[model samples]
Target: MTEPMTADQARAVVYDAYTTGLPQAAAAKLLTGRATPAWVAHEYAALRRRGVSSMAGQQTLFDTEAAE
Candidate 1:
């Protein structure tokens, strides 16, 4: 059997899927092997709660102005 994915791995998958406009359920089924849409949604919520930024490292106008 395939090994379980770590939290970071799952987060990366979810993030990539989201950025690419792929459906969460489809991403779970195709990439995670065992994860469900609910789980992916939960992970995504947690990532947001933790303030994880986008892969592109984009900053908001507020952030840019604050830095200056």
Candidate 2:
């Protein structure tokens, strides 16, 4: 079995997928082991609420493992 991912890794994957305009379904497949697309969408919405729409914003949002 694959090792469980850290929250930081999950966040980064979600952030990158969203920023790159990946379809939610595609992201769901890509992240099946980590999170569902609905959950990814939820995180996307949260990031938008925080004004995190740019690459820099994504990095800042997920750069630190300590934050989670």
Candidate 3:
């Protein structure tokens, strides 16, 4: 069975896609098969859990439900 890709993996996928000239939306779709919401959240959460600076001031909310 294939291992699930983590947010870092997703980020790498995004980076590769962007460098390859893929549009942000299309690249995210093709690589992540999901929206940017959980990706950013998981990243930040993981970092904070590890006592690291995860996005911090750079955080952006892609999860509408989270704002509700």
Candidate 4:
């Protein structure tokens, strides 16, 4: 049986998936992609820990990482 996810738990998972270099689109393709907007935002925030700033925007970070 599947367990229900809390808002906080969903956010943490989203953050982890994003930081691992998975595109938001791809992340969304997964069942968990339908997570709350707040979770997605939190995911972006977590990316900041990887030398990426949320204020810089997601596309910017993806392109920058690609170039590196």
Candidate 5:
């Protein structure tokens, strides 16, 4: 079996997915064995709370919606 992912690694994955416009729930599903949807949702909330500008210097769909 593969090793479990660290919290940081999971967060990074979630961040990358989120920046690509994937919803937190969908990203969580993608991490099936690595992280839970609840955990991913929490991390997503934290990112929103922190006002993360962007991972690739471009606003995400979610960001645009929030701005409108």
Candidate 6:
């Protein structure tokens, strides 16, 4: 059986999935053999709560810079 993924691994999956607009289920399937979409979704929420910016959020970067 595959070992469970670590928090860091989970974070990477969440980041990639979130930034690329992929579903949490896709992230789980791509990253961890044993991870679930629900778990990845939870990680994604946790990342947002921690103030990690997603690509969607970064869309404003160019606008903000142009305003300067």
Q: Best candidate per TM-score, number?
A: 5
Best-performing candidate as measured by lDDT: 5
Residue pairs with backbone overlap in model 3: none
Question: Residue-wise lDDT of candidate 3 within 1-68, one digit each (tens)?
Answer: 77777767776655454444444456556655444744544543454567643332233334455678
- 14-52, model 4: which lDDT tens digit per residue? 665565666665555553545745556556656666776
| Residue-wise C-alpha lDDT for candidate 6, range 1-68, written one tens digit per residue | 66777878777767867776666677777865557677887887887798766666346545676687
Which residue pairs overlap in candidate 4's backbone? Answer: none
> Model 5: how far is 53 from its true place, Å?
3.9
Tell me the deviation in Å of residue 7 in model 6.
2.8
Number of colliding residue pairs in model 5: 0
**Segments of candidate 5 deviating more than 4 angstroms:** 54-68
TM-score winner, 2 or 4: 2
Q: Please give, for residues 1-68, the per-residue lDDT of candidate 1 as tens digits.
A: 77887767877778776555565676677655557778887876776687765443334434577688
Error of 4 at 41 (Å): 6.0
User: TM-scores, in order shown?
Assistant: 0.51, 0.65, 0.42, 0.45, 0.71, 0.52
Error of 1 at 4 (Å): 2.6
lDDT of 2 by residue, 1-68 (tens): 77898878888887787776666677678788688777878888887799866465456667787587
lDDT of each: 0.66, 0.76, 0.52, 0.59, 0.78, 0.71
Q: What tens-digit string does per-residue lDDT give for candidate 5 at 1-68?
A: 78888888888888888677677778988899788788888888888788874454345444676687
On the 0 to 100 scale, the lDDT of residue 21 in model 4 is: 68
- The regions of model 1 sitting more than 4 angstroms off are 31-33, 45-68
Mark the 10 consecutive residues where model 5 has the least summed lDDT: 53-62
- Per-residue error for 17 in candidate 2, Å, reads 0.7
Winner of 3 and 5 under lDDT: 5
- As a whole number from 0 to 100, the lDDT of residue 14 in candidate 2 is 77
